[model samples]
Target chain A: MQREVMFAGFGGQGILLIGNILAHTAMEEGYEVAWVPSYGPEMRGGTAYCLVVISDRPIGSPIIRNPMHLVAMNHPSLEKFAPMVKPNGVVVINSSLIHIGSDRDDVDELLVPANDIANDLGSIKVANIVALGAFVARSKIVDFEVLRKCVQEQFSSKEKLIPINMAALEEGKKVAQIK
Target chain B: MGKILMKGNEAIGEAAIRAGCLNYFAYPITPQSEVAEYLSRRMPEVGGVFLQAESEIAVGNMLFGAAGCGARVFTTSSSPGISLMSEAISYISSAQLPVVFVNIVRGGPGLGGILPSQADYFQATKGGGHGDYRLLVMAPASIQEAVEMVMTAFPLAEKYRNPVMILGDGLIGQMMEPVEFPEHLRTEPSNKDDWATNGMDTRKSSKPNLVKTLFLNAEKLEEHNVILKAKYDRMKREEVRYEPYNTDTDYQALIVSFGTMSRVCRTVIDDLKAEGFETAMIRPQTLFPFPEEPIKQAALKESCKVIISIELNMGQMVEDVERSVQGGRPVHWYGKAGGDVPTPEEIIDVIKSFVS
Candidate 1:
């Protein structure tokens, strides 16, 4: 079986970073993985996106036109990629930045206030992690314990920052649990 | 260590180190600048030299100088930068030195946008430089394969005393994937000391070695060209590499593709099989020493009716495919050339149309 996740947002939203984390998690789980980024001239504040492909078999193409899931951190990303997600796929919207819904009932759409959740836990930078937590909790594409360990390893160098990030993750997971 | 997740660009940098290549002279260009970004710091820590040359021209000449001195050297660039280095490439080939050049190709006729492209197929497999010379070119589809190729390239270059290029598209350079480097089994060419200008004291013989591309006499130049032709012919006889997919099954159509484009074709083949359509593919691992015989035989399969050459370029590799098939099968070409890779769905549609 194979599943792909497209993470889209404006640059500086750590869209690529979270995609890296997911790919890393999948690798740790012994799944074949590939992370493809749309690397254009945009370094900051411009559109940034990445796709992570996880598979039980060797991955053939890292490029995907219709991904299995999407984590849209901004409204433009939502409008651009939401419709392209496959049926029964989970669409996670960062409700903190995007006020509108995906308006599609064919799939599971989880509205997550990631930035707000991160801010309540002390920093808005962990907002991507919050969205990641929500996505993983809903899709179960990866084990939550494995993801938690992956997140811990991601911030292992910065020991003090791990708690707030952990708190943001839990808060996001809580949102996925609702409705 | 176990497998580490790394970007293709950085993995290539480390692969060079593992292969015992010490000198890296390069100019940065996108979708591949990360190699320089990676090696800049890592090289010093490993006691290797990493020089950011003023231009691709300087980088190429620097490779010539270092490789002449018997040091393993390499440089990475996208399309236009490679063009700047082409002059030096030809000179190095004429001088008969071992060096490695990597082209993480971006779309181009000139200064094209920085995105994945295979348009450099002709520029690489054919001589980009103005000479009767060819680079031993290997195109890698995945980061792991890229690392293996980079490591193998040094030995291959040294063995033939010719430039070897690791040709990858922008995606191979920009994407991140897991890689475990093969053990360093690369040994210095047994004959490098015989011709390299490493200094009289370092050589068994006392004569000073000279490295020059200029053979002013026409007869001498003709002899040089003949020797180069012999080496290329030897390469064709020995180094052709290709992977045939789904050919075990009776298939109606065959595809000839390389690099990133081949991976997309593989997906199309798999999807078509589920719908009960049988197709086969020949994924060329070596662009030079083009797998003419394998493709020729695959096209003659009783079940195969049409042959296709799919690429990211408009139709560069198609010529090679047609020449290989020799009109035994109807060869078709399908591609796009504006930095946009054709999707698997689009390819499937094309393949279905071809089959019918």
Candidate 2:
């Protein structure tokens, strides 16, 4: 199986982190994965993004033109990448900040109030994880348990932050399933 | 070793450490600055030397001094920085010093933008510096290959006593993938005791070993050129490497490409096969040798109709492809330059025109 995902957001929103987490989980599952970030000067405070391609076979190009999934964490991301999602693919949007909606009807849209959900869980930094959990729940691209374990390993240095991020993940999954 | 998720730039640093490279002097440039950044922290831990030179010019001279001592030394740069180092590179070649340098190429000509590009094809294959010299250029298509190429480059450089280059695009440096450094490929620290200028105490002979490139006599310079040409001749005979896909079948057309562009062509050929059109592709793993014989043999296949070159540069490797075929069949080119990378669909569109 092959899945290409584009995660896009503002520079400080952990867009690249989410993509990296997903790629690590896929690698743990014995799949070949590639993660390519938008490099150069524009990456400082601009629309930071990354493309993750996971496959059972060898990957050809790391550049993704039309991704099977797009996780947009802000309004401009939604405006830029929503139209590029493949037909019958999934577009997961953070509903808290994005006031506009994707006009495409052929693709599936999973709207998660990631920022609100993380704020309710007492931290805004976990919103990217919330969006990631919702994308996992909706698309079933990778096992949720593997993703959680990867996140835990990433933050193993800080033991206290793990529980809240785990809670935020569950909250996002619950919201995604209800929608 | 186990698999580790690594960016291409960081992997090059780690691989150099594994390969027993102790001295690294470089000037930072876009798309490849991470190589220097990663080594700055890593070199100290391994008890190696890592210095950020004032400029590419100074870095080139530093590399010359380090390598002349028979040390395994290397540097990384992009197109413009590589251009600045060409003067010292020629001197290093004439002195027969073994140094490995990596060029994560960007868009060229002048101070170009920091994006993935293959516009340095001619600069790499043909000598970018003055005089008669050639660098053993290896272009890798994947992150794993990039790591392997960096590991093997040290030995190859020392064996030939000539400079070696790893030519990759910005995409290869920016992309992240799973990689493992093979233990067998990790070489012991190179033995520079033979001709190294470690002073009179370390020398076995009473006479001093002079390490100069100047040959004031025209006959002496001609003799040096003949020796360099002989070494290059051996490299071509033994080290030319290329991979052929679907050439076993009676393919209709052949596509010639190298580096990341060759990976995209793999997908294009697969799609064409699914559509009941069989094609072949030749991916040159070593760009300096140019893999001319393989391209000629593939073009001579009775079923082969046309040969096309798809590149990221505006028809740089295309000239090499045409020369390889030697007018045996029609050779065409489809490419773009100045930071624009061609998509697989774009390559497919061009291949479809050839089909009709």
Candidate 3:
């Protein structure tokens, strides 16, 4: 029951936030989880990424060279990681921003219009939350309620942003289920 | 007592706080700068002193100043910066000062890249500075172990009245994992009047206590070295730590690695086991006062054919491996310098070539 996921995008696209939310939710669900982000000088607008590992048992190695899932939020991420997805794995792409699709037929590919869905919800910044919603809905790695709780916990101090983010998650989840 | 996801450098800083290290002096270095940044925030909350010194050399001297005042102190740096601190470290050792220094190693003969490398094994285990002394060195493979080792290092340094080190690499410093903090216990410095230069009082004593490494007499220096050697010999007997993986089986090869590099070796061992290759690893948790007896015995066994020492440096630990094996088995070395970490598959490939 070991699962590895990589969320990659430009620096301001909230790739790290998405991965951290997933890791936090997994940890809350009583699973072994680790979230590792890119460090050093390359973290500024130059392909920021994070690796999240969730397992039922203790993890052997934290470094994930081959991931079970990849969530690409932009064209560069899709171009960089789509081919590296394991056979019979899942690749969720933000179709609103990523124009390219995977050529491999061995894996499952989901193209969700994350930005369009977030814009419809009245905020373009919630696209990352939408992509996260889509991943949780399709993969079922963590419960949606637990993820929501984690989101609240992360943004608890900022009471003004909580309702909008929760609404964004629900909207994303609904769109994922319909698509 | 619960797990919290933390980076290695951040974990060490927190552990030092938990271990009752109230005074921290350090300069920023890449791959280890998080330690200082974390302490800068955390120490204030805990009523501790966290000073960002002028440089690594100044930081080491600051540690000396704090230790002289009977305060538990710590500092962290990378390769080049550690080289700058070596002189102070040697002085601290000779002065028998209790302090902890962490070296989050980066690759180098000189100003190398800001990636992980184990090239400082020799510099750490052997005498890095001009002296006949050894600092108790602990290597951590995971964030949890990093926390525990740091917590233990304070007591060990105090117990031995000498400096201790937490030697890690850039990968360990940067990597994130879950860590459990130790039971909350406050550590207070004991026996301050014994050697501390805390402002003298007339009622206490008439003599002044000076902490200095200078022994003008040749015979006294030899005697000091002998005493230091005895302490090191006792540490070798008591403090050798290692983890044995798959040692029960008739292994075709034995892999020796330590610090963050050992995690990659563990992955390689698992991969080779899936492919029907019998391999084992001897991971040294303590680099200095190394677990040599176990390695020597393992080398003498007929079941273990080849010993491979894997590191991020060219061949620093390889020399120690050769010494431990005592020429009974042919010791091989594999490494990638300048902050390059070898992949698990690359390690497996190197091991497969040795299979006779």
Candidate 4:
């Protein structure tokens, strides 16, 4: 199965990092993956996005026009990419910042209060990771264990922060499981 | 071999290091600046020389100086920066020095934008400077291919004793993919005792070597040109690299493209195949010593009704495609310049016009 996921938010929200971590995890799972960033002047405070394509076969084009999944971390991102998600695909949104819900009835929408969950876990910065956890849990694109490994590997540089991020992942998974 | 994900620019830097190229000098430019940035920290760790020259001109000369002294040296730049390095590149070509350079080409006429574009197709394959010369230009489609080609570039440069270029666009430089540094592609620099000017006393023959392009004598200059011509011909004969897809079967249209643009075409070809439209593709791995034979054969296929050349520039590579097609059939061109990369759907729309 081929899964193309787009992660979008502001630059400082670690949107690109989530894409990278997912790419790494997918590759580790023996899938071909490509991560492409939307790079330009708009990357400052404006909307930043990265596309991650994970496929069992060799990936052809890294540029995804309509992704199978959308992870929107902010209002702008949700508004921008929500409609572009393919019908019968998955849309995971951070409801803490995005008040408007997706109108599409064909796709599955899993709304997680990512910031609130991350804050409850201690830090709000890992909200992206929380969204990622929610994504994997609801979509089942990757296993919870694989997502955990990805979180550990990504935060390996700052060992102290690994535990909190892992906690964020757990919180995200719990909320997603209920949905 | 474990698969590690890395960006194309950083992978190129790592590949150069793995290939045992210990000298790097370059000026930063967007879409390709990461190569220099990665090497800045990496070269020091590997005991290699890394310098951010004051300008691209200075970087080109630094490459010339190091290459003359028998160092495996290289540099990276985008379109405008590459223009600045053309003079030194021509000199290196004339002097028969082995240097490797990567142009992660961006859009141009002049400082166009930082986004990916294959505008440097003419500048790279054709002689950019004022001389008859060719850089064995390699264009890699994906990050892994970029890594492998970069590793192979060093040995090819030394074997031919000519400047070798890896021509990529912003997509190839920015996209992240899984890559492995194969042990076999790792090569040591050949001993340059014969011609390198690494202190004349270091040679067993006790002879001094002067590396310069200034052959004032008419006969000597003619002889040098003849030698370079022979090398280029040999490269054409032996080093033409390309990949063809769905060419074995009869197809309605043949699409010729290179670098990252070809990947999108591949996806479109698959889509067209599913939709019952016969389509084939030819992706050139080497832009210089271009795979003209394969392209011509693909274009000449009996079922092919139209030949389309897709590029990121305003049809720069299409000229070469036309020459390869040799007017046997109509050659069409479609492209978007100044940092706009066309989507598979966009290319599909173009292909539809050809068939319909």
Best by DockQ: 1
lDDT of each: 0.91, 0.89, 0.85, 0.90
Regions more than 4 Å wrong, model 4: B184-188
Q: Candidate 3: what lDDT?
A: 0.85
Q: Estimate, for each residue in A1-179, the C-alpha lDDT of model 4 and write its tens digit.
A: 68999999988999999999889988888999999999875836899999999999988878777999999999999888989999988899899999988889998999999999888888889899899988888888877798799889888889999999998888888888895
Model 4: DockQ against the native?
0.80
DockQ-based class of model 4: high
For A92-178, candidate 1 gives per-residue lDDT tens digits of 999999999888898899999988888888888999999999999999989988988988999999999888878877888889999
Instruction: Give the docking tier of candidate 3.
Output: medium
> Stretches of candidate 1 above 4 Å error?
B185-190
DockQ of each: 0.83, 0.74, 0.51, 0.80
Report the C-alpha lDDT of model 2 over A1-179, residue by residue, as the tens digit: 77999999999999999999999999998999999898866856689999999999999766768999999999999999999999988899899999878889998898899999999899999999999999998888889999889989878999999999888778878977985
**TM-score of chain A, predicted model 4, versus the true chain A, to 2 decimals:** 0.97
lDDT, model 2, position A18: 91
Model 1 pairs whose backbones collide:
none
Interface RMSD against the true structure, candidate 3 = 2.1
Per-residue CA lDDT of model 2 for B1-356, tens digit only, reads: 67888999999998888888988999999999999999999999989999999999999999999888777899999999999999999999999889999999998779878888899999988999999999999999999999989988899998888899999988899889999987653443355666567676765667676678999999999999999999999999988988898899888889998888888888888878888888899999899878999999999999999899988888989898999999999999988786657778888889779756
The list of candidate 3 runs beyond 4 A from truth reads B200-207
lDDT winner between 1 and 3, please give it. 1
lDDT string, candidate 1, B73-187, tens digits? 8999989999999999999998889899899999988887888899999999988899899999999989999999999888889888999999998899989999998775454
Who is ahead in DockQ, 1 or 2? Answer: 1
Range of the 10 consecutive residues with the lowest summed lDDT in candidate 1 chain B? B182-191
Model 3, residue A179: C-alpha shift (Å): 4.2
